[model samples]
Target: MQEPPLRELRCDVAVIGAGTAGMAAYRAAREAGARAVLIEAGPGGSTCARVGCMPSKLLITAAKAAHDARRAGEFGVATGPIRVDGVATLQRVRRERDRFVAGVLSEFEKFPNEDRVNGRARFVARDILVLEDRDTRIAFGAAVIAAGSSPAVPELLAGLGDRVLTTDTLFEIPDLPRSLAVIGGGPVGIEIAQAMARLGVAVTLLDGGHALAGLRDPDLVARANALFAAEMTLHFGTKVERAESAGDGIRLTWAGKDGAGGSGVFDRVLAAAGRPPSLRGLGLEEAGLSLDEKGGPCFDPRTLMGEGAPIFVAGDAAASRPVLHEAARQGRIAGRNAAALVRSGPTGIATPAPWVNLAMVFTDPGTAAVGETYDPERAAERVVGAVDFSRQGRARIMDRAAGALRIYADRAGCLTGAEMLCPEAEHLGHLLAMAIQDGQTAQDLRDRPFYHPTVEEGLVTALTRIIDGLDAR
Candidate 1:
């Protein structure tokens, strides 16, 4: 019997992936009067709602409540002993997670049915895509690649056969393990390790180097290490060479940079190494797009456009900024530019103004970095403003005094970047980002009102140090 012919469809723009960036790109293209079709493979909810941010935060919130209750004795307000129910805690996490995913699905419902394609897509030509499941061919004037990302497992941890988990699979477990070995020291690893540790799990965090959560300042890195070390086992400068299934647990053997080696066995192993762009089987090379060292599409960061093709890569697929807000911004930019490519043919459009850079790790005393974070290699070129939060009035009053803040300024006295490890650093990160975005000087921020008896007042102390440094120069 002869097979049926493939169905053919056409659109002004074809967006692959239905995550944050893909959704934003589709909306922008449609708003620009372009026919845009969104192609997604099975999973519909974005990574943030599904696994990355929301669920993790829900878990962390539960962990924080338990931690605070255990420490109620410091405030001399103790009702009774605190006990954590692991099963109940995770049940609530999954329950709240489903609610958040439902909201994202509602947004997916808003898109027109004709614009949605349910299948995996691969580029067969520069302007064409073939949906393998539907046996449909789509021709587009321009395309946006927003095909999200997945957790990557290192070769050393492969074939362990059981109990090896990544962020993608970690949250779905029925209950917390008695002990966990976190195999990466990046943001995800650090956050999960701390949260699990606080919830009565023995978490051991291992890293090949001393870097903690992308902190660039030596002082801050040391401070953060000291803080985290008090709670869990930290094995920096240690490289894991072997992992194997040992009865009901996994055995990990490692060698340290100091010529020391150690081995341990844990009930579970979490490979929080990193998340690479999920572009497998998309046939990027066939689309005439080049790959970088990390296997991401080679595209201009400013326009999100591939160097030699009429294709734009955004979100986690672009492998630029992996956060949700950055993904949304890239989606809008890529969508607008893709539509312009369709409407006005070839000559590029003006790029949107860049957004301020802000990132945070949701640890107890959170870590935040805004703009160009401090780098010791360029120490002489910038002035540093420092504050010890342990001495801040609000921190001492609240009995949560265990963090530091560092703000950076150029020689011209303009506020440039900041890195901090303090309670509510997320808010401080946003405030600093706005000042830097507005091109404000250290003196300008100093003139602004700083309310008394608040964590924000710590900013005044740091700014005064910057002014003093400027005067001395």
Candidate 2:
């Protein structure tokens, strides 16, 4: 059976953006027996596969290899004069990044040609979208805006030409810069700054705020900040006031909050400030949908319905939770509810319980915050148990002993949240997330089997402290 031509067509649901959330919504809508069309603008690939997570991790892996080799002597293994070939290192990153993107493209191929449109979509009316590139108008019964985000380059760095880089442009560089100034204290900036520093680049990280990687606990933040400062120069509560062309490089002048200021010349300046939702020029107002302060759709987070209209928003466009898994969940919910609105009209749908909140930073001693993280307002009701991995048995065995873990519980010992700056914190974070979601107590987690002389033993030690704290109360 042949589908109708694109000159004039109506879809039960029209999904904008071909990234992670958009793709999921399109497939989900079809599975719900709705006629859906997936729209994209030119080049198609997820931010993670193309530039964000995959490529950054590749670079970090190479840096870790170099760092480990340099420290092998402490483990009684001699690795003499470890050298990193910057060109070869980045070439491999690009090579592997292409393969990951190819995998995402393969998923795109599964959708039929008639169901995919290649153009930027803008809403002309509540039920109508115009593809600006081809002048094609599509009428949709319901819609999902999963359009992702873009790097927010600071106004100060705009005129520096190619000397400036963002995560989107960082991987494409042919070689590592001799000196780098990373202008952000967020995850992307911290991860890339440390990676470049470890890979023999002189890195200076500048942030206007004092927080490091979103850790609320001052102790953990201090620990992580000290660990990162040991490798790269960090300036917090400071802003870059000026940038200009220098002889073969760029010069940046920065001012501290306390009236202190300095200047430096660097081969490149990375604008890791932030990634705002890519919502400009989408004509969202024309669709009768209001936007939030962040320029994202004002919608119900659970149903993803837009302000009582027949529209939905997911992924970065929602500007709520930008994580990939969260985006995929929102996309699924939006698609299903859109189909339901078309078929049965907005009733009898059971919204799932809220998801567990988890976040991780892939730095040397990884950092993670899971579930109900530390809050000063709730401090009186919470008991915190902490363990320093510096003394943990397995940490000493592996010579990777440099971080701490803290678990939080209420007076009754029910696990509430956990934060860590520890080696292999990713695994520990996941374990804690599951326990918190299941309403497990500190005593319950302590009873769980922990293999001897492993990083996980540190978790057991922390759980025991929580139980002890509970008993004391």
Candidate 3:
């Protein structure tokens, strides 16, 4: 029997993986008047809604309320003993998560039917993608890959069965664990550790690396340890040795701090270790793409363009900026560029404005970092205006102020970046980002009026210190 002819169609760009970045790219490409088709590995809503940012944050908010209610005595509210129904809390989280997931699905529903392709896509040619399930071939002018990422489970922890969890499955539980071993020091690990702990779980946070939250700033890392340690036992510089099933749980063995050895059996083990790009089975080599050391398609971080290929890689797959906002921004940027590359010829690509990149961790006394930082090696060239919130007015009133606000600038007093573990730290970093984006100096931020006794007042104090140091120098 002769092989059936391959089904073929043409489009401006074939967008693979319908996550945050992929959806954004699909819409942007269409609005740019380019015919683009989007292929998703699964249903729409993506990780953020289904499991990550939204659901996790809902649980965090519940945990925060529970913790705060227990501490009502500090404010002389005279509330009696408090209690939390963990199952009910989880149900609420699921309820809200379903709503968020539905919202994202609704956005995808508005897409043109011809543009949405549901199947696994792999490149069979330089510019050709074949839907693995139905043998539908799409020959496109260009392509955008935003396939997203998966939790990086360490080799030792891989075969531990259902007891091992990631952010992807952490919320599936009806009740919080009695004891949890969180195996990472990244944002997900730290945030979830604190959340579970506050919700009445005994959490032991372990990190293979020395720094927490991937922060290398010695001072900030120290502050995070001091704060987060109060809630859970945190071990750094630890290497996992083994794992095995233990009475409906998992027993984890590791070399503890200072090369000491220890082991523990936990009700649950969460591997918030890292998020490596999910590029398996994509047949990237067939698409004429080279894989980098990080297992991502080697693409220009700024342009999102594959080296010498008519492809733009965005979102977690690009491994440039994994945050949702950054992913969406990358999607739009790559989408517009891909459309122009196919519709009007190659005109290159544009990157985001300088010094606009930022990151945030939503924990109690949350932390945020804006601009280029987390380095102490180049501290000499930078001035740090640090304000300890231990004595800050609003923090004292709220009984939640126990971190530092460190703002950085050059000798010229320009606001380059800021890192802080404080109340509403996310908002402070964003406000400072505006100044940095607008080319405002530290003095410029200081001149802006701040309401009295607000957490932002601490920012003013730090900004004043920066301006003062500039004058002294």
lDDT of each: 0.91, 0.89, 0.86
Ranking by lDDT: 1, 2, 3
Stretch of 10 with least lDDT, candidate 3 = 346-355
Query: Where does candidate 3 stray beyond 4 Å?
Result: 1-5, 351-355
Task: TM-score for candidate 2, please give it.
Answer: 0.97
- For model 3, residues 1-473, the per-residue Cα lDDT tens digits are 97778777789989998889999898888888899999987866887898789998998999899899989888888778777898999999999999999998888888889888888999887898998874588999999999988888877777787688888888888787899999988889999999999989999988888777656567878888988889999888897889988998889899965869789999999999778777898888888887777556788877788976799998888876688998898889889889988887866556555348788889988888888675677778887798998899998888987888888998888878887788888899899888888989888889999999798999888988888888888
The number of clashing residue pairs in each candidate reads 0, 0, 0
* Residues 1-473 of candidate 2: C-alpha lDDT, one tens digit per residue: 97545577699999999998999899889999999999998477888889888999999999999999999999789988988899999999999999999999889988999999999999989999988754588999999998899999988787788899999899999999999999998888999999999999999999998877777788888888898999999999898999999987899999999999899999999999888888888888899897777656788777889984689998888888888888888888888888878878778234777788999889989989998887889999999999998899998898888989989999999999998989999999999999999999999989999998799999988998888887887
Clashing pairs in 1: none
**lDDT, residue 139, candidate 1:** 97
What stretches of model 2 exceed 4 Å from their correct place?
Answer: 1-6, 348-350
Superposed Cα deviation of residue 124, candidate 3 (Å): 1.1
Instruction: Tell me how far candidate 2 lies from the true structure as C-alpha RMSD in angstroms.
Output: 2.7
- Could you tell me which residue pairs clash in candidate 3? none
Model 1 weakest 10-residue run by lDDT: 345-354
lDDT of 3: 0.86
Any idea how many clashes model 2 has?
A: 0
Q: Give the C-alpha miss distance for residue 131 in model 1, angstroms.
A: 1.3
Model 2, global lDDT: 0.89
Better of 2 and 3 by lDDT: 2
